[model samples]
Target: MNPFLPMTRQDMENRGWDELDFIFVSGDAYVDHPSFGPAIICRLLEKHGYKVGIIAQPDWRGEEDFRRLGRPRLAFLVSSGNMDSLLNKFTAAKKTRHEDAYSPGGKSGCRPERAVIVYTNKLREIWPGVPVIIGGIEASLRRFAHYDYWTNRVRRSVLMDSQADLLVYGMGEKQILEIASDLHQGVAVENIQDVAGTCYRVPDFDYVYDYVKLPDFETVAVDKKAFADAFADIYLEQDAIRGKKLVQRNGEACVVQNPPAMPLTEEEMDEIYDLPYQRTYHPMYEKAGGVPAIKEVKFSLVSQRGCFGGCNFCAIVSHQGRIIQRRSHASILREAKLLTELPDFKGYIHDVGGPTANFRRPSCDEQLQRGTCRGKECLSPTPCKNIVADHSDYLSLLRELRKLPKVKKVFIRSGIRFDYLMLVKDSFLEELCKYHISGQLKIAPEHISDRVTRLMGKSNKEVYRKFVQRFKAMNERLGKKQYLVPYFMSSHPGARLEDAIELAEFIRDLGYRPEQVQDFIPTPGTLSTAMYYSGIHPLTGEAVYTAKNPQEKRMQRALMQYWIPGNRPLVREALRLAHRTDLIGFDKKCLVHPEKTAGQEKNKPRKRR
Candidate 1:
């Protein structure tokens, strides 16, 4: 068993190391698990015979924590953990979030806002000329100029703001190794700009070639049209096979991004997952009750990487790419067997999946050679004719896992593409109902309105309804009373009050009261975020109406949970505003009663006694 990476100088000495090759600074607590990006990168480096140390969630307010590990020999790798710092710290309403699952003790304020920029700035302050490389979800998604929801303005690429020597976007396994190799051979960070999946800034465009130049930061910052156009170009060119090198001028410097790193093969996937991960948070965190993030992934086996679901609101396409890269069934089973050997092993294996659990291979055969279609989605507005929907590999993997000894149940808790499932002509659903699901299967059918769903790049209401019917039929055949907990989003771009009301009526008809509702948050680097900011669809250039007002957003959210007594007022107001007062009445079909009717019931309540 391999010991955890050194976090202190004494650990370095214990390992008989005089100096380290790289020091990773992360916004999340050090979790030596594959689920955490920092851990995977650090461990991958260690596997390549390099000395790596971690400085997880250091105090940016003081210099002590930053100086603890001292300067590294090669570079300082930085990330804002698995999630964007702004999204992690705040809600859709821009309210401060009190709990951070990534931090120790589930406490907020462990990492500074815009953590990549902050941490990188601190590293520069302390280590002067040492190379600083930034990646992870925050830096990956913000590799190009993007709209900041909190600031309500277009900000330059994180590479420009953080001033990191290189920005490794997407999965960093491929990029990190190349960067490390070059740095080990004594290559200057500035000359390493040609590496794939990395972004570097140059003072001029002299050395840059064969790249698509995006709209200048100054223009995109002010002109919405330019912002939409630039985003459209950025979105379509994200594929690894056919993607183009991109460059955008940020004031005096031009940030040049190389083509994305190629997807890892099955053997590569196995090699990375097979690394000696402690599979939990570092022991130092035990005193703080352990990191809150590990509970979700400790037993979970990541069967695959990447998703082709292509939801507009998701950042997977931008970060993990659209192609699906999966581990071999043997690799996954090996991890499951290992899970069974753990001291805390319960009979249950929490989950066995990745971004989209059902996806085991590329969406189509052409994706490997030609890449995904530029502006067309595989399973969106409609499933493309060429789209290949297969679940045999995944189903077989699940069956093998179920047959394992000491394993009670294997659940597929990761988001499953119901639309894709509907396309498969197999017994996967039957098996899913019988062995995988635990009474309820959660699926994201963001909104019921086809008009709104179209903007969200999700399947229309008809497809979701058909899938629901099929799920019910399958469950009935199995004699199980399982339910589909359909997830709904409110106030997404192009959703008006009428759309929200339409969704509310659908919920009323289904007699489903959603315990939680997702209010659309316009985070950086999503197609929906671009639409939310530009009021125009980047792909089609269509006008989209987004609910930016707090009250309207509240009403939209309330409409989804109309059954709750506390939401009655907002639901009533939303109904009235949409000219949907017909839905507000003292009738069985009504979502809420009128104010006068409530008052009358209050006054006549004495009869109840």
Candidate 2:
């Protein structure tokens, strides 16, 4: 049996010596993606002089792999998938096959929590006193509870149930280093409170600052549920969360819940970019007998970390930080050379960009680093709360990436912020059209309604229309066939029947039936989640619409994929349900059906307002 399978009594006896230095468990994902927990961590620890071995993709149903990797190690780190929605969407599908059913790995009923329960139990059985740590997008997003879309109610934090000695949230490079250092110095894992980014319970815990304190570990050991509940009920304390700190119950002794780690400094960020990344397949793909990702697809190198466009729906600002930090042209060229050397190298590079791709420098000159101009929001249709216009260095990198040998074509597959693109300096667009895009560009305009667009903080729908016109004129003048694959999001708060139908109508008029429409899923750690909770922007104090009904959400999602042929019945029923039966088949009479289009012309959603 594979070492990663179920553990048996023999498995326990087989676990070598019950002692080792570092045991790293990871969720399977592209190793090169910046957010990958295991890849970055394993490398970081090994850099600090630790013997690290990874057990990738351990089956919760089996314990053999767990047993093999088990040791009374310095520290044991656990990670679920890099994404939380990938896990939640997987679980949500089992309950509602009516909405698009998707799970993290696409297994029928495998949920994220089950991965936790199994791993925690196995770790306890094999190495009783050894510390077990949980990190990754799964741990970070649910660190606190804001809302539960599938159940339509607020729930407690995930920390209450995951059952790990500690939960490390966010990019954990520095924190994990501190953890390993503490363990090697002969400190008990429970004494790991000083390390930033770790959440644990200690006896008689109280921060020197004297705020809410953790329970004495005896209390937690005696009544785990009570301690878990204590951390979950903090409505007021969580609202003031800054970069990473432990949270404890109101008044408990001995228990210490270390907070998460703070953001990295410019110096640390620079160092991380210098880490060697050939950004390819798993080392054992040949013996493993599976197609590692590095085989068929090769993602081109681009920006390192950060996105200034703070779209509440996105996690980029929260996780990677909003300050755009870019790698130099020479560094990018080095990686490009390495990519070209790969045996499976293709003539094409998938993309070379980042959040709003065009942003290269931090948004402000040093003087106003603390804040931005109040009127800055007036610049774009949605004026992303975090938009930074960084283009100089970005353009330079683009130029260098296109000049590589054996690299016939370089594509900008990264999402284009259409609103920002329209304002691109004419010189930049000239370059953009000449060397980068491969005829088709992918951009997200999100929605058509000005009301929903602003609320979602997406660019105004009109800017998209103007952008489309300009793009066509440019292509025509250049005698080229370049076009955009504009992305749209439906069912955001403030979006109702009108907004969706308008988008549908636009799709039909343009004779463009998109293969997919992204219905918003409120992942953990996003401003979007906050808006869903309070129906207002977390940064701006303004009212917003919150979509709560499952059936309505289904209709909105179905509308996006309505062009898929199999979705026609659902689309028809939904149109009639919304009292816009005229759109059932888009007949000429329905177009004139007074009650479907808009205005006082008698066309209105016949369903429910």
Candidate 3:
């Protein structure tokens, strides 16, 4: 019999199990790859002798779909898939997307608009008193009071909205096991309070000892500064070792977030990856063109977890925390060998990375024990003196993978910390240019303005410039015709028209036209989103100028692709708005041609005689 957990009642009966210990309800199609959260959790539970069933993308409008798996003996786990449902459904401009990559056949609206809440509410209607737990990227990051981009308001924690018994945040291997063990021991869900990396609601603040109290929901909802202040307090206390428990009042109940879970050791990471994941979508999805989300990760291997890059716009710091946990080389190479045996074994291993590709170890030794410093970052503004920037272990791993029999190529698609790369004193860049890059190497400089970069928790612009120069020199040394594809962002929290113009000038100097540009979307749990909602820097509490105007944001996006003929008008308008008409004439310094008078157009000189 196949080892995959039962997806239907028939599959369960065939295995001679009358009931399951858990039924995981997900918003994404069932892809039994390790990259999918439901697969990992189910596989892990099964490994511990627990019978698990999966209910993927259940119909949200009614309870019949959710009841397909019957009721679990333990609890029901709910997740909004790998991405937040609203983010998956809409573009940055709040327009509905035509396709959902996580859905079968790339279909739109396969899941509810607010998946976690909808799924949990429906499960409650079907099995009223059963314990329902929410996790994954949605519940993990939004476990606290946060701003919802779609609603355009400060909303209470997802814990309050979903009414789940508990939220298992972060990467859930450690927390979920603990929760399962406790529940199996007959403890009530409400009493499972002391577990790390979990959140539970209470009637008052009495039980939360020595906890930090955040600005109440009412205050943050009406006052922008209070929102910023609340976010600041939450940001500083994310570390596992030094962090304190946090409490936020929501209506009559209080939401309490326990400290972050400690990072896994090398052996622990190996065990998680060694589970028997089919590493592909469930066979049932084969008819509907399969799940599109698996193609990107089918050939990819997640070498590590957690990131210390601390980019303000990213939610990793909140979800994964600012620590790095890596899998051993033996484990990764073992997975590579398994890939070679698969029928679809393309010679290329698409990626061997995580949040940041080259971060194979923690940033520094002290961070492993003392935790990340409060109010200080490892690579933004400047690399800290204690930061140990080394890539020898990562480079060694790549070389080992190259030596495998059937592996033709290996690429690094996940982001690399350019600032950390610049800090390393090795031939990592040369080797990366020679072997790893797939023609064009993509890196994110994000923006050229130091003001905006600072707000982004990115290193100063000079650092990216140095990395670009080094990349060119390395590619030239290797005699390769490779190009550097730099990514830039528009209209983030601290960006203004002048900053966008400066970025446009920077792109002009590069002589490269970007086909795609990112307009900042204030997703929940990011410091940038807090700034977007509050108009105040969470770290500094100073008011910032955010480009909220739709036309202005379009203009900023146009400036990045100024070479496109259709974007000329928007670029011209942007230049004019910034009072930089000098850049509107048809000259070497201009971004777009200025409007010409009829008389001047008629009298223009002609080359023909």
Top-TM-score candidate index: 1
TM-score of 2: 0.77
In model 1, pairs of residues that clash are none
lDDT per residue, candidate 1, 327-419, as tens digits? 998888899999999999998998989999999999899999998899999998899999888998888899999999999999999999999
What tens digits encode model 3's per-residue C-alpha lDDT throughout 170-229? 988899899999999999998999899999999999867999999888888898898899
Task: Find the candidate with the highest lDDT and give its number.
Answer: 1
Q: List, residue by residue over 1-609, the lDDT tens digit for candidate 2.
A: 223211233333465434447776655532543324566677666556675666665666766777665573686777765555344444433343212122222333333343543566667777777788887776665554435555555544455555577767667788788878888898877667677555665443334454454333244334434333333332112311232244443233222334434445555654555564435434343354432333323556655556655465876654555545666666667767777887877777777776667766666663124432332332345554454454667677777777779888777767666676665554566567767777877778787777877766677767888988887777787788887787778777778866777777777676666765777776656666666655655445566676567777776766766666555666666677678876755474232222233465466548866
Q: What is the number of backbone collisions in each predicted candidate, taken in the order shown?
A: 0, 40, 0
In model 1, state the lDDT of residue 450.
Answer: 88
Residue ranges of candidate 1 with Cα displaced over 4 Å: 597-609
For candidate 3, the TM-score is 0.98
RMSD of each: 1.3, 8.0, 1.7
RMSD in Å for model 2 = 8.0
Runs in model 3 lying further than 4 Å from the true structure? 596-609
List per-prediction Cα lDDT, in the order shown: 0.92, 0.59, 0.90
